[model samples]
Target: MTLLDLTAPPSRSDRLTALPVAIVGAGPVGLAAAAHLVERGIDVVILEAGPDAASSVRAWGHTRLFSPWRHVVDPAAVRLLETTGWTLPDADRAPTGAELVESYLLPLARLEAIASRLRTGIRVTDISREGMDRTRTRGRAAAPFVLRTQTADGAIGEVTARAVIDASGTWHSPNPLTSSGLELLGLTDVADLVTAPLPDVLGRDRARFAGRHTTVVGAGHSAANTLLALVELSRSAPGTRVTWMIRNASAIRLSSSTEDELSDRAKLGGRVEQAVAAGEVDLVDGFEIIRARRDGDRVVVVGSRRGEVVEHPTDLVVNATGFRPDLSMLREIRLDLDEIVEAPRRLAPLIDPNVHTCGTVEPHGFRELTHPEPGFFVVGMKSYGRAPTFLLATGYEQVRSVTAWLSGDLASASTVALTLPATGVCSTDIGGAGCC
Candidate 1:
C-alpha cells in the first residue's frame, strides 16, 4: 500500500538533491534534528509512528509538562521558527501537552522544514544494513541501512538511506507492570485493561472509580503528572481516593530550568512537595511492590518498604514506572552494547538523558550503548541510558553530539575509563578471589 502523501514528491532538481537523512519519529527531538540537517544542506525524511506531531501529547492531552515551553523546544526547531518570524513562547510559563502540541509541534510539521519530507502514520518496524552483495544499484553501493516501514494503508515497503537516526521517543514502550512488583490486579493482564490508542483518562469511566481506592505507581515526572491530574479529578469527584506507590519513598520531580539548583528546588517542591501537602493523596514511600491480586471488586497490592512489608487495597492501579528502547527487533544483529548501560553505548563521555542508554542504566545497569555501524545514531529520551531523566536539555545535547558524529565534524569521539567502586567484600573474604 502507498503511504499517505503528506506533501507532494520533490521535483527533478529536488530529487537530484543530497540523499535525505532518514529520521524516525516526529517528537521534539526528531523535528529538531531535521531542522539541523536542513541547515547543513542535507535533506531529511522523517518517519513518525503517530498520525502527526503531538499525538503523544494528546495521549495525556490535558496534562501539563513540569518543564516549561523553553525547556522542551529544540534549538534547531527554534531557529527555523525564528526564520519564519515566529516569536518564541515565554520560557517561564508552564505549557500543557495540548498547548505544546498545538502551539509548536503542529506548526513546525506544517512549516517548510517538515512539509515536503514528512511522512505521518508510518511506523518503522525494523532497521538493518542493506547493500547489494554483487553490484547493479544506483549511486555507489546500497546505503547498508534499510528502514522497513508499515504505512496506515497496511502497505509494507523499505527505504534506504546513507544514515539512520532513531528518535522514536520513550512512551511507546512502557515498563512492564510486573517488573515494578505490581501483578495483574485481577488475573487480568495489563494489556487487557489497556485500550489501544490509550487516552490518559476516561471521563465516562470516571464515575466508576469515584470513592474507590486507586493507586498510581512510579517515581518520575510522568507519574507525578498523572498523580496531579488525578488530584484534579478527585476535587469534584471526591469519592475517588488516590494513593501513590513509589519505590523511592520520595518522588523525584523535574522542572524546566536548571539556572540555579535552588530554582529547580522550588519547582520540584511546588508540584511534588506541595502537592503531597494536601491530604487527598496518600504517599507510600520506601517500598517496592512485590505482588498484586484481585480481591473481589478491589485489587490488593503487597510490597516491602525499608525492612517491613505491607498491603494496600485499591479499585484501580497504574504502573507509570517507565520505558526502555525496544532494540529487541535488532536482537539477531550482533552489536556492541555497554556493560553498564547495555545500550549501543557510545565511548563518548556525553551527558544526554534524552538518550536511551541513560534510561537503560537506571533499571538495567549499563552506560551509553554504541555500535561500530558508522553514520548511525539514536537520540531522544530512549537514549537516556537507563537513568531516564526525561529532560529536553539532555535531548538538545544528544542531537548536537549525534549530528557531529554523523557528519564527521567532531575532532574525535570522546572517551574515559571508569573503575567500579568496591562492593564491601574483601579479596581475602572471598575464597581466593582476586580484586581489581
Candidate 2:
C-alpha cells in the first residue's frame, strides 16, 4: 500500500495558476482583498484564526470610530455587498466597531463569494514556499506556498496556495509595559488586573473599572478613549478614578482645529485634552514603567520619571501602549523590513509618525508593498509594524492595489487613487476607533 508523506518536499508539479490566493485574515482588509480578487475573476481563499470574521475588531467593538461610513467601506467590498442588497450606513455618520462589523463586515463575509471560500477557526502557524526552504533561490517564485495550520480543535492541517497575503492585524499582540519595549517585570503577577487595550468600559467590562482606580498607560487614542470613559464612569459609580500615563514628557493631543479634515478625530482628541485639563484624569507624563507588582489585590506600577523612581498604585492597569506586528509565523519567508518601524523597507518612511502625519504621506501601491518574496505581501495594520496611526482607508487602498497586481493588472496596481485630505487631528482607525 502506498502512503503519502506530508513532510516530504514539494515532489509535485507547480500548477501555480490552479491554486488560490490565501489571505491570512478575515478582518476588513483581508475580506476586502477577497472581494477584489473575486471581482477580478481570481480564485481566493480566506483563512481566519478566529471563529468569526473581524474578531479583532469585535474585541474592541464597543470603541467608537472617528471615520464615517464613507471612509470605512471598501469600494470593491461594497460592490460585492450591493449585489446582495446590503444597505450601507449613513456616509457621514461615524460607527462604533460593533456597528461596522454588524453592518459591513458580517454582511460582506456572508456574501456567497466570500462565505464559500472562507475558513474559520483555523490558524496559520507558519508559511514558506512549498518543497524548498528559504535558502533555495532557484525557481522559488513559481512554487506554491505552503502553510502549516492548526485547527481550533487542536488538529494540525496544511494549506497550499499560489500566493499569500497576510492581513492578520496586530490586535492580538498588544504592546507590553516598560520603556524599552520589553514585557513588564512581574506582569504575570497581576495578569488578572491588566485589561485589554480597549475594554468595554461603558459596557460589559464596566464592573472591572467602575468604582476603582484605573491607570491607563500609552498616549494613543486607545488610552484617551479609556480615560474619557472612566470620567463618565466616575460620575455614576462615584470613586471611579482615572490616570493617564505617557513615556514622552509632552502629550500629543488631537488637533481641534477647524481646518482638520476628520472632525470626529479632532473632537475625540479635544475631549481627552479637556478631561486632562479638568483633572478628571491624573496625567503622568514622562513616566516609563519598569515593573508591575501585586500589592494585596491591587497592582503597583513602578517606573522612572526624570531619573527618579516612582510607584503608582491602581486597582487596574490598561496597557494601551499600542501594538506591534508578530513576525514569528513568517520567519521562513524573506521580508525586507525597516529596522526601526519594522514596516516593509520601502514603505516605512511614508507612514512614520515622527515625520509624516495625516494627508502628508504619499499615496502608495503595489510597488511600495512588495517584498523580496514574489507572491507574498503583508497588508493592513500589521504592515505598519511598530508605527501607530493606520487609517482603514489606507488598508482598503492597499488591498485594491495588491489584488490588482495579483490579477496581473499592473496598470491598476500602480495607480494610486486615494489620498488623505488636509483635514485631520488623529490619523487612522478600525471602522472608527479614532486614530491608532
Candidate 3:
C-alpha cells in the first residue's frame, strides 16, 4: 500500500489539523508520548482502559524489575515531574512494579497538564478514517481519525483526532500452551487450573501453588522470576513441588562474559541455574504440549518430549509463554507488518528475536514505526510485536520521536538517540516476554 500523504492541502479551515492527538493507553510509554507532545505545545488526550493509570503494569506489581530507576524514567517525564515537586527515586535501586507505578508513572499522569487531558476507564475498540474504510484512499490523509471507545458504564462514544499513537503494550494477550500456536485442547474445561502469566506465586496466589504440584512453561526473565519465587515458597510449604518446562533443549543462558551492563538481569538467570543444580526444581527440556484435560481435580497435560508422548498431571499450570499485540482493533487501519514477528516491516529486521538480543536492537524512530496509515504509530512493547526483551528506556525514545514528527519537527524525529543495556541470552525467546 502507498503511504498516506500528510502534506495534502486542507479544505477551507483545516479542521482536522486543529484536533487533539489521541493517545491510546496511559501506561509508561503512552504517558511518555503525552509528555513529549505537551512539551511541544500540541494538544493531546490520553485514553486508559483501566480504572487507574498504568493498570497493566500494576497487575504484576509484585514482581521486582531488573532495570534500575535511572534507565526506566524518560527525560521528558522527569522534566514534567520536577515541575510538580516530584523527586526521582534512587538511581541505583531496582523497584517492584508497584513502586514504579507509585513513584513515577502516577506522579507524571497526575500532573495538571496531564490529569486534565487524561480519561480512565475508557477502552478503545476500533480505529479508522473518519468517514471511510481502508479501501477508500481519496482525501484519506486529511480526514480526521475516528476512534470507537466504550466507557466504564457501557456507554459507547466516538473520539476524533488528527493523529494517534498506540502505546498500548502487549501485556493483555498471552501465547497459549501449544508450540504450534493453536488453542490449548480442553482449555475451557480446565480453565480454573491455568493461571495467567506472572501470577503472585508467593503472595496473593500463594494458596493455589503452596504445597501442590505446579508446572511452569516458558524460559525467560519472567519464568526465572517465578521459579525463584516458587523455590522460596517451597522452603516453607511442605509437599510443594516446582517443575520447569521448555520447548528448546537449552533452558536459559546468561552470558558468562560479564559484559552485561544490567547486573540484576544476569543475576536472575544465575539464580535459576543454581536452583536447578541444587535439585530444588524439576527441569524438562524439549517438551511440546499436545493436549490438556481435566482428570478429576488435577489437570493432565499431554505433550511430546524428544518424540515420545508424555503426560504429567499437576494441580496448577502457569502459562508464561510471552505476549502478542491485540490487532483486532486496528483491522480497518492500513499497516505494513512482518509476518514472522508481527512488528513493522522496517523494525522486524532490527528486533527479530532469531538474530538479535536486547542490547543488539539499535535505536529507531518515527520512520521505522510508521504504517501505511498516516498519523498512526505503535510504540513501546506493542511495537516490538511478538519479539521480546523490550525496555522502557527504548520506549521513551520512541515517543520522543513520534511526538516530534506529529508536531512537525522532522529533524528531531529522524535522529536516533537511545542506548540499551547489553544482554547475552542466545537468540530470541518467544517462550517468554519481558519489558522494564
Candidate 4:
C-alpha cells in the first residue's frame, strides 16, 4: 500500500485514505508526528486536551531538564523551525520545562503547516473503528477510526480519521500514595493536603511549602527535585521543615553525581546529597506508608519500617511516586500490551527498567510501537507504561519511525537510529530509575 492508494476509489485497501490521520495530544511527540506527515504532504490533524501545546510540561516549568537542548529538540522539528528563522538555543545549555515550551513546542505549534491542523481543548475520550467495535474484525482495516472527544465547553463530539496516534502521556494519571499500589486508608479526607508530582516549590507554589512541614515520598528524579527545592525554601523560611521518605534501606541510589554522564543531572544529585549530609533535610529510609489521615490542620502519616510501626506528622505531602498510563479510554481498541510493563508487548523487553537504562535500550521504530489495532499507535511516555525510562529524544525517534511506516516507507521505518546518555551506574532499584 502506498500514500497514493489511500485516496483511490473504494478499493479493498484504499477505503481509509478518505480521512486525515488524527493525532491525540499536542505535546512534543504528537507535534513532531504532525510535522513529519505534513512534510510528506499527508493529511493530518492534532487533538490536544489542554488549551495550549505542552500543557503538561508547563506544569513542571520550574524544574530544569537534565538533558541539554540538542537532546530534547527533534531533528525534524528543527528543520521546520529553521525555515521560519527560529534560532536554536545553546546546544550544551540545559533548559527548564518552561523554556522547552516557549522556545520549542509553542513555536512548533504556531508554524503555518502545523497551526492550521491543530485543535486544542479537545480531549479524546475514546477511539475505535467506524461502524465496528472491538469484537468485529472483518473489514476493520478499511474502516476509518472514530474518535469521541469532549470539548472544554462541555460539549461532546466525534471525529473520524484514517489513522490515530495516541501520545496522550501519563502526566494526568499519577500513581497512588501507597507503596503496594493501592489507595491508602483515609487518603480521600487528605486529598487537598496531597500535592501532585513536580510542584514548583521555589516559584508560584512556594507559599504552600514556606512555613509548613512537608513530607516527600518516592525515589525517582522527581522526588530528588522536590527534596532539593524544599531545602532551598528552608533557607529563606527557617520554620519550613522538609522530610525525605523512601522504601529503600539506604539512599545510595539517589546519588550518581561523580560518574553521571549528564552534568546537570549530576548536579541535581549532588545538591540533594549535600542537603541530606548537612542535616537540612530529614531522611526517613525504609518507610512504607500504609495510611494517612487528617489530624487537625496537619496530616499524620502511619507506616512500617522492618517490623516496627512508624508515624510522622506533616503539613503537606508530595507524592512523587511517578505516574501510570490511563488505559480506560483504550478498552474498545485491540491492543497487545505487555502484562507487566503495559507497553506494546514487543517493545517492553527493550525498555524494561530491570535490565535496561535510558541509553542501553536499543533503537526501535514503527514495528515496536504498532498495536493489534491497525492504524493505531501509542507513542511518547504513554508507550513506556509504568517504566520511568522514557526520554524526549527517544519519543521523537519513535514518532519519526511511526510516521514513515504509516506513509508506507517500511525501509525507513525499520532503520532505527538513536543515541542516549548512560546513567553511569547500572542496576539501581526500579523506583530509582531516571530519564529526561
Best by lDDT: 3
Q: Is candidate 2 or candidate 4 better by TM-score?
A: 2
What are the runs in model 4 whose C-alpha is more than 4 Å off? 1-13, 251-253, 419-436
List the candidate numbers ranked by lDDT, top first: 3, 2, 4, 1
| TM-score for each of the candidates | 0.74, 0.93, 0.94, 0.93
Judged by TM-score, which candidate is best? 3
Predicted candidate 3 versus true structure: per-residue lDDT over 1-436, tens digit per residue: 8654434312422687689999999988899999999999999999999998999888888877766677778899999999878888998777778898999989999999999999999999999998989899888877889999999899999999998999877777888899999889989989999988778888899998999998988877677777888999999999999999888887544332355556766667777888999999899889999889999889999999988999989988999878888899999999999999999988999997777767778888887888899888999888988887565677788899888888777788888777544532211221222322
Q: How large is the C-alpha RMSD of every model relative to the true structure?
A: 11.1, 5.5, 2.7, 4.1
lDDT, candidate 1, 1-436, per-residue tens: 1121212211222332346679988877788778777766677899887888756556655555544565567677778878788876887765656777788888888887687889989988877656432122343223456788999899998987766777876566665554443334444533333221222543545665566666777665555555665777777776877787777646543333444222433354366555677786788887677766666666777767788878777777766766555675454233555555444545333433444222222211112333444445666655544444334554555565555445544432222111221111111110011000
lDDT, candidate 4, 1-436, per-residue tens: 1112222122335656757899999987898899889887789989999999888778887777777778787888899999999988998777777898999999999998999999999999999888999899778778889999999898999999988999988888888888898988998999999998878899999988998899998777788888888988999997999999988886544556566565666676778878889998898989989998899989999999887988899999998887788998888898888999899888999999877656577777777887778788999888988877676677888998888878877778778787554522111111212233
Specify the poorest-scoring 10-residue window by lDDT in model 1. Answer: 427-436
Pick by TM-score: 1 or 2, better one: 2
Candidate 2 steric clashes: 9
User: What are the per-model numbers of colliding residue pairs?
Assistant: 41, 9, 0, 0
TM-score for predicted model 4 compared with the true structure = 0.93
Cα deviation at 237, candidate 2, in Å, is 0.3
Distance from true location, Cα of 300 in model 2, Å? 0.9
Where does candidate 3 have its weakest 10-residue lDDT segment? 424-433
